[model samples]
Target: MFAGAQVSLYPMADGFVGVILESLSALDPYRDQLRIETDDISTLIVGPPEVLFPALRDLYCAASASGHHLVLRTTLSRGCPGEPDDPICDTSCLANPSEPLAQRQANALETLRLAPDMGQVADAQFSLYVMGNGDHMAEIMGCIDFLKQSGTFYKSKHFCTRLTGDAGAVFATLQQAFCQFGPANGHVTIDLTVSANSPSKR
Candidate 1:
């Protein structure tokens, strides 16, 4: 069996990278097949179902402890008859490849039975801390403004942006925001949370 997943790492990029590399190395022994690809904003993993689950779980733990919030989406491969699909394939199969990690997570979460009566809305809370850059606060605000102008966030606050919409909308927004931070100088840290709640409950 094969599985693929995408995860969003919160906090400093270096911290997130460190956590993932560490977890993957620790889980390597159990992985019958493993392949990882990462860019600035996210990471993708493809491997045997058994190995991927543990790796995913461990990655989550490490990121959480390091104060890096994450959003994960997984798919179980049902290989075609007489032909086993590639153990690791392209990332296009991921649901809403265009959406941001946060939105994707919120959308997936809304499918759960968290509360029977509450309406489901995509929610996000995140903070960014930039080190080594003087006037860090201003730069961060500039980044925030770029995100807002780009319409990546539904409603943006000082540092915590709240998105209320379907999962796709939320995810797209967050991913866009992550990309926006690329040009800024200094070390960047992000703390993110994506969730859903019934309208009745919120």
Candidate 2:
């Protein structure tokens, strides 16, 4: 008869409502019975089983599409449901930054090292800018993806990717990640650093 749902979105984006709809569309379609409402803060949905499941799925999907790490929880009842669950209550759904920064940085570099080679060029050091808002986990993941997907370099485990690349290539990679950051780029700042040993003079 009634239920409470809580949806929290991080690193909010433009057309966020659309992202939510797209996400919902991917889930069980019987959710038409539900009545859903969302504000800048969260989304609240109510109705029977036929309605709730689909609504919840959309909430999950939209957050995912917008590059937001999200969490949703439903409290069921006979008449009325309370607010949606807090993202912190569910560890699995929440983004975590419990790992040390050094570990995160190392993981980013390791991802860069595993890519295919670029002809004669060697990808030396990876300069990753954990761009976007304060959602550290998402930004870390973003940096990792940029390192691996961009055509600038290949993967190597022995040496640091940040220490060996062409200067231009490294900057290009940093620029790409910054661009993908979207809204997160507003409140937060970007930083990228790389170091290469001195080469012999011409």
Candidate 3:
């Protein structure tokens, strides 16, 4: 029951320090919501998906707005097997003292709502490994259908489906799939990977 990501941000421009610093600064507001660690190579963020995705959305949007070439690559996962238990694994945030499921879905939906139609901005891709369901195949297919209709998913793969179109729509579709099919009992898990690159200014 753990969710985390390792991210590398590359801003392609002369003396890119300002852009990099600006992007890192964007995470400051999200510090309380995420478990963040940065070093020489990349930054690591760990927390609930409800909190993590929006932080990514805001951070990336701000970074890409620099009018400089930038690439943000990430590996995100939840309920991963053999991942050691940590504070980020806490389930307390999944539910409220009151109507837990409703609140959880609402929080998850917020992430999707923040997604921007990156179609005019960037072309990106992400992968999801949806796990732990008896009717998983049907649910998975439904998710694929949902993505296809959204015009964000490009093709289906064996282990992961490749996504396309606007970065925001792609992310929105991904989050929507997880929120709709993700387990309510905490028995299911999903592993995700995202790459935001290739400016659509083509």
Candidate 4:
């Protein structure tokens, strides 16, 4: 049940160092709940999805509040076969493997509806990977359907889906995509990039 994320933040501003350091404060509240370590490249946050996603949302919103173009790149994973199980990652939130896909999608949408509004807009593109055996595409397609129904959905793109809205809903959608659809104890991962205050808008 090990789960975590490797996150790197890029701020398009002259005071990038300050922005980065300041944004990190957003994770203070989650420090006791997560094992976080930062080096030159990225920060690794080890925790359950329940705490992981909100920590990410707050961190991103803090950076976005600087009014500078900001980009957050994260690689999130749960139940990786190669990783050792950790007690810190324990949680009851993952969808049951036997749960019907339609039911899972319904639950995901309901969760999104209750996501908090962070007052910051985010545009994100990501790909969900449900690793290991079983009908992978079916699970992926079911997640895609959930995303389309998610209010944050922006559009579909090559190799990934785009989502736009309040940072809360967007991150919640990403969390659902990671938590639902796949086997409860199976390996699942997400490659995600979220942007805010970008100068160019298509």
Candidate 5:
């Protein structure tokens, strides 16, 4: 029932400090809904899936608005056995594991369709980890199928999948993958890197 993410933002510009500090304001509206702590390394956001992903999207969008190359590295997790459950992390957005995989995929795709466009483009890659036993590969493969049809899927990589499109849809796809592909109450995590306005593209 607990969900959270460790996020670090990198702005590939001379005024990186200013960009990072200013973009943090994007999380202001979410402060009441999430537990956020920032230090030298990364910012930790603890909250429900509903709020967590949007907060990340807003933060990235705010920074990318500077027209500088920006990268966000995030590790998102839920139902970690090692972490104590907190009421603030409670959410009803998770898929029921007992539900059929096809139904879950359909639900995920529908959700992506409704995702709002954040007016920014993003290129991202991530690996979803479904911890604990019980047909993990089936769940992962099912998630892969969902990604391909997500409209943001770019391709498959060695150990992860690549996604590109509007920031909103991309992040929504990630949220669905995190929530729907694993056991309803099992530990699940994602390692993700998102980029915008990269000079390498030019």
Candidate 6:
């Protein structure tokens, strides 16, 4: 499987150059776990979901907290045809990982609270795993309905749906989708990949 993200962060503030550099530095520590490449336009990171999500959360949280208006734009892809395979894309790395994405989100949310309001656009992809018995298709449709009403959404051929909206609201909606609908009887899990960008095309 191929799992990777190409991201670009723009900090809108005075002395933005240093701010951007410092903000992007947050991903440096994950060098061992991911294959990261940075160029003139964006940074591309390839790895498994376990490491990918945490790294993205940390990087976004740090960049948003930089006391400046920030915009993050990214294109995330996985399982695309003709893609190269990599070991890190497998689920084995997460079998016993110490920290998971849910935990990382808690921390990211804390930091994101301090970020100023800038009317940014956050885009994300989610694959809801509907398990257990009882109207799985109905439940999936329900989730999709809510998301569609919540913001802009696109159903991709890659088997994931994309959503875009205000950063806070987008994540909050996602949290709700992940938490509430998976009732005690029904089981569901979501794999999410998110990105944000300011001054987006409307």
Model 1 scores a TM of: 0.37
Error of 3 at 76 (Å): 0.7
- Per-model lDDT: 0.45, 0.39, 0.63, 0.94, 0.95, 0.61
lDDT of 5 by residue, 130-159 (tens): 999898999999999999999999999999
Q: Per-residue lDDT of 112-176 in model 2, one digit per residue for the tens?
A: 45433222222234333332346656664655555664555556343223423443344334433
lDDT tens digits, residue span 118-185, model 4: 88999999999988999999999999999999988889999999999999999999999999878988
RMSD to the hidden true structure, all candidates: 14.4, 16.8, 5.2, 0.9, 0.6, 9.4
TM-scores for every predicted model: 0.37, 0.28, 0.69, 0.98, 0.99, 0.53
TM-score of 3: 0.69
Off by over 4 Å in 3: 87-120, 131-139, 154-168, 182-201
Per-prediction backbone clash count: 9, 19, 1, 0, 0, 1
lDDT of 1 by residue, 1-202 (tens): 2334555544344565676566445445545556776676656666643344445444544444443444433322222133345635322223343454445444434432221222223455666555563566654665566545433356767757655444434444444343333222223444556533223433
Higher-scoring candidate on TM-score, 1 or 2: 1
- Candidate 5 is scored at a TM of 0.99
Worst 10 residues of 5 by lDDT: 89-98
What's model 4's lDDT at 197?
93
Off by over 4 Å in 4: none
**Number of the candidate with higher lDDT, 1 or 6:** 6
- Residue-level lDDT of model 6, residues 29-65, one tens digit each, is 8989999998989888888655665566667767766
Q: Report the Cα lDDT for residue 196, model 5.
A: 93
lDDT of 3 by residue, 1-202 (tens): 6776778778878967888778888788879878899888878888876667667766777777787777777776666666766776465434332344344445545545556665334445555455664566655565565666566666777677776656576666655665555453433444554444445544
